[model samples]
Target chain A: MDSAISVHGLRKAYADVTAVAGLDLEVRKGEVFALLGPNGAGKTTTVEILEGYRRRDAGEVRVLGEDPGKAGAAWRARVGIVLQGTGEFDELTVAEVVRHFAGFYPTADDPDRVIARVGLTEKARSRTRTLSGGQKRRLDVALGIVGRPELLFLDEPTTGFDPEARREFWELIRDLASAGTTILLTTHYLDEAETLADRVGVIARGELVEVAPPSRLGDRHRAPATVAWRTAEGAVEATESETPTALVAELAARFGGEVPGLTVTRPTLEDVYLRMIGEKA
Target chain B: MIGLAQRQGALEIRQFLRSRESVVFTMAFPVIMILIFASIFTWDITPGVSFTQYFVTGMIATGLMTVGFQSLAIQIPIERDRGVLKRLRGTPMPPWVYFAGKVVMVAAIAVVEIVVLLAVSVGLFGLELPSTVGKWLTFGWVTLLGLTACTLCGIAFSSVSRTARGATATATPVALILQFISGVFFVFTDLPAWMQQVAAVFPLKWMCQGLRSVFLPDAFAAQEPAGSWELGKVALILAAWCAIGLVLCLRTFRWSLDR
Candidate 1:
């Protein structure tokens, strides 16, 4: 199927709180789709529903062409999930855990290769408890991909990683996507979505607010630019302009030379995201 | 499914062995208790049966409960809170395979625990082993039925506590209360009639009674509350509890506390 995951009018509530309210989404085969939202914005609730870990109150969900809520072991064999704060086998070595999970799938990848792919080859022989937080997360990724799943779900895979570690993890995700595995990622990091996702969907307050490529989110490319320059009095002057280039040219001519401290900037992805989510950047 | 359960069992045993504290505590606690009780209580319960001989059988029953019920109840909740069970549920492996693995692990440990208790009883306390094949058969069925009942009960009880510490608090008091009332620490006939009735409602009392039949002399069966070994009643009660435990496990078992 062209669509690896499809949901229509999904709804879930926890007693008095509505977690995912009438949300709809889709992820095409071989594409990395990122779900971006703040905490308690229904990102995890929606992903868990699609992962077959939670039941929806009202809607339909199909993962890999079968309804996840009623899917059996055969359907489970084709799906991989790396949940938040998981992969803690405190008494077992990394190699042991990875190899153990590989047995559950009909077509599994080599555990050692999976470890190496996640840059955890050196720590494979060490106990999982002994690994650093970042290394443990790498082991989590190794276990996630060992099943050779056609579709993978990564829920906040790099939440606690350092900048360099996050970059390394992004590379690992890119490699998986290149291997033709469809990935559904959830993250609040705007740069991460922009760098990895073919399309990013922003969920806010239990509903999807917008879905588009990062560059085109909220019409970012065509939004008015904020043109700022310094006057002779050493004060900053700024204005919103539809044509920043013309504004800069006019300012430069007015000054009889280059405009001092000139800067022309359209809204960034983060700015648009924060604005869409009703938060001040 | 069998292959996966076997692998899971092997992994579980390895992990259990690696945890030095749990290994020492689960296996050693019963052995230590048997040694202490044997030393302090040197009196005879009847004409030919010393207190050690009678107490050893009770201790065997207690050991089974410790491993099968207490350990699983305490450990499963910790695993649940740690997200171990949830992670396993996400895989292609069936849920029953996880429980089957637990049964395998518990059975292996229970066998070793029984052997060690028996050796201590015979070597140190001079407790006699069953001579007749019929008595041996009694020992086999009682141990198997009791272990299965306790293990299933433990899995069901695991959902009662939200955390490992809570599980320990809940499981320990319940186990201790049953041991006291079920004649593990006292003579069955010496206990009050109401207490005997309460213990009879639970499986541990029947397990202890069945084991006493195998380990104690036929003449000593006179001291039993029923004035006989009552092997049929013991088997029936334990089997009934096993059925009840299975139903509870099917109804109450949870993969995680969050759900």
Candidate 2:
């Protein structure tokens, strides 16, 4: 598959500090690639460079088959960005803001349909400033997709979303991916990344440490599973195993089936993420 | 490009009109300041020059100041702080189109404020209207040129304000000091020669002097006035300032605060 975004030896430094140091990455077309990192890890810097908002000191970066640094309006039209924050247009209703932004693109989706997709149809007439946090994020997403862009950049898109809202946002992203729009997402929430990302990349200290499928990330699912059960002494015994199903079966036989308070747990993405970040520190 | 510029220009006007507080503050403050100064000094000033004409001239100058200084210094910084500038930076639209749209909107607002104030000064306060149509046209263009200077200067001022709260305070001190030295409140002739020299370096003095020429009679040049208030010179100075301001603003403006 053709790559939507490619970076080679990307290096950006300010004065005496280096933000991105010889970093390399590739995001294939029509894939949701999530970049996870700690604060000051150069995630935002790299994304800004790709968005053409800032010039890099030295790097080779291509977005949507053209060098982003030199791309003009035609290239810009293909890339949609949903930033972490939004502007105040209190006089404008949701429909007005969406339609207004749609004017910037050569070919844009219908404003009403885009609003409906983000589930803001009911609040179409409400002023933007009156919308709740989740609703505002929905509007931002609506504006981002109005252009029918080939590639979308979402920076901490669900930073302020509630549990229910975050889940709904994941659905919206998945639908966009299904429609064949490539996405590059930078987020601090591991669950958000795992839930929506086709593949996850862990970034630490301005370096791409690991990249893999969400379930197989950093031995995340394959790591030792904790198997615990109640013993005859009225206490508990536990053991870590590569094969928890087999261990549970053996325990069931010895305990005559249905062991009391039996529980099987595995290391989650968050567990591995913390360890990776800690090791970098 | 023209089509997009027109559409964006209309939207910018709509956005400005939607915000009741900013519009009110931007238009009303200068008008009120002009009225207060006119009322206080009208009785004390010498004859031959109607305090009304003096007041009208100062009010027009205030209009220029409003559009040029406050619009850029305060409003631009506020908008930038709110992430509006950052959001626009991400779009596919040409940067010039965006700036053109803003300049067009600000010019309109400045014109409306000037017209209303001039109408009230002449119609309500019995101030002398301009003697000829050419004088009126000169008033129109000079105010516009002065406003253009201010808007560009506002863009430059926006770069100095790191936070929105700091923008107003940062701008007011410089504005007041210039107002005093530029003879906006007092006559430049009455001030020290050095003070007059210092005011000449800035555009505000020329803007106010140019407005005075439009409203005052041709015969009034006898009273030790600073040389001729040449229209061509006024236009040239304003255009020069506008060009310099644009270059500086584009060079230094930041989309977001340093992190």
Indicate which candidate wins on TM-score. Answer: 1
Model 1 docking grade: medium
Error of 2 at A265 (Å): 2.2
**Chain B structural similarity (TM-score) per candidate:** 0.98, 0.90
Clash pairs of candidate 2?
B68-B150, B72-B154
Q: Give model 2's TM-score versus the native structure.
A: 0.95
**Please, what are the lDDT tens digits per residue for candidate 2 over residues B1-259?**
8888887778778878888887887787767776676677666345667666665676678667776687678877787888777777677877787778878788778778877887777775666778899888888788877887888888888889788889999887888788888877777688898998898777888788788888777766544354577678778988899899889888987776733
- For model 2 the local lDDT of residue A103 reads 88
Give the 10-residue window scoring lowest on summed lDDT in candidate 1 chain B: B250-259
| Residue lDDT tens for model 1, B117-229 | 98988999998899999999999999999999999999999989988899999999999999999999998888999999999999999999999999898988888888899
List the candidate 2 regions with Cα displacement exceeding 4 Å. Answer: B257-259
In terms of lDDT, the poorest run of 10 residues in model 2 chain A is A83-92
Lowest lDDT 10-residue stretch of candidate 2 chain B: B219-228
All DockQ scores: 0.68, 0.62
Q: Scored by CA lDDT, what does every candidate get?
A: 0.90, 0.83
- Model 1 chain A worst lDDT run, 10 consecutive residues: A272-281
